[model samples]
Target: MSQSDHDCLFCAIVTGERRGHIVSADDAAVAFLDSRPLFKGHVLVVPVRHVETLTDLPHTRVGSFFGRVQDITSAVERGLQAAGTFVAMNNRVSQSVPHLHVHVVPRQRKDGLRGFFWPRTSYGSDAEADDYAARVRDAL
Candidate 1:
């Protein structure tokens, strides 16, 4: 797919100019583990095309992109054995990265991820980090 550089992280990721903890990838989209996860199994699904926001893309692309997102969500739900999944897309305001990507956060009851109220805490040690990574990798 064609892309423009100009402040687009997803484009870099798609082109292999940047690194991310990718889970699944197809011709149209890629799914990766979130660096700063809302939950243990949080993942991000992004289209190959570079669109600043959801509204910026064409309807066909949007539909296809979301379809991919749904597929990833299902994988995350089953793989992680999650009680549920929270799928979200950010526009201009919530757009941390300019690219149009969807978040698929695996949720469990009493996991303390309810409603995005809890603050994220960094891993205490390398062992803890590795353990978390292993868990997520297993789910993928």
Candidate 2:
């Protein structure tokens, strides 16, 4: 553990310094029920290490970390008998906690939550869309 780990809420949960309704855990990651859920059975999957953001996570650890997330996605859907699920991650913006975590939210038709967390918008024109795509591709 590092200095940052001691300050991270999720790290405390992983190390048993704090309480979390843990659903799953292994060498790679730990998963738990969200205290404030979008719906019942919503789960948060996080790496065991104190990674602050997805971009900060090592490439070598990515597959193993997300593998745990994938397994929990299945378990949450099956265990809750949900129609489906909404999985998401906020890297830094809108991320209440700094530690990297994936949200697995159970979903059903007409379950109140709609579209997503924000309103939809369009690029206005094909040229505008192409410009945005080109910028992203260039960055890649």
Candidate 3:
């Protein structure tokens, strides 16, 4: 997308027009803790310029966008002490927000996440969410 969508939630967060548990940001992408996380330290990485879906992302931005996703995946694992991570993206159908974003969830063996059936949990409080955001941000 050439410009930010005024009504897009991710765009609002990316532009600092809305509050988000922001973890990291740069020219190419932004990373933040998912309000409803599959696990603590779950992060959503999105292109700085709002693109509704992966197919809409410019070919030139694909590598850098995903490189940031890769970095967030590692950060989630290191910061949360997860065994690994569940990294995924959905197109228009299951996409919660219209903007393109990749979910990088901290995972451990037997954490009970199965397939696409994600069971979400909250940070319980703003301070808790801030703590999680801080840990990942420090790792980044």
Candidate 4:
């Protein structure tokens, strides 16, 4: 095992060496409720292997890892009867854990979840956000 794997909490959870409230598991990934949840139904989806960042995750495993996240995102919304869901990942900054975890946060309209950035303001326009999206998409 690599040094990171030896020191990794998520890896221990994935291997069953550490106890986690595992909600789902498969060959490619694992899904579990967050120890500290954004909401009751909040879940953290992670790759079965120890990958510290999205960019570090193997491209071959991307589909499987995110497929599980997508499944859990839907389940979080449906099970909690949330109006919507906020799915996000932090590469390194603001990441409480070292593992690559995708947070599936349940959301409702006007749930007071605003200001998600540094004195953050909402996008000036959908077009502006779309321009950012287009840049990212073009890169991909």
Q: All candidates' lDDT scores?
A: 0.83, 0.93, 0.90, 0.88
Candidate 2, residue 55: Cα displacement in angstroms equals 0.8
RMSD of 3: 15.1
Whichever of 1 and 2 has more lDDT, that candidate is 2
Candidate 4, 50: how far from true, in Å? 0.6
TM-score of each: 0.75, 0.97, 0.80, 0.81
Candidate 2 lDDT over residue span 93-121, tens digit each: 99999999999999988999886789889
Write the residue-wise lDDT of candidate 3 on 49-125 in tens digits: 98889989999999999899988888888888999998999999899999999999989898899867767888889
Candidate 1 global lDDT: 0.83
- Please give the ranking of all candidate structures by TM-score, highest first, separated by commas: 2, 4, 3, 1
Please provide, for model 1 over 1-140, each residue's C-alpha lDDT reduced to its tens digit, 9 standing for 90 to 100: 35355557777777777898888877778888888998888999988877777777888777777788888889999999998998888798878988878899998898775575447779899999999999999998
* Candidate 1 TM-score to native: 0.75
- State each model's C-alpha RMSD to the native: 14.5, 0.8, 15.1, 3.7
On lDDT, the candidate that comes out on top is 2
lDDT of 4 by residue, 1-140 (tens): 47768978888888898988998999888888889987777888989888899999988999988999888988888888999898989999998889999988999999878736457567899999999999999999
Error of 1 at 124 (Å): 47
Model 2 Cα displacement at 19 (Å)?
0.8
Record all residue pairs in model 1 with backbone atoms less than 3 Å apart, i.e. clashing. none
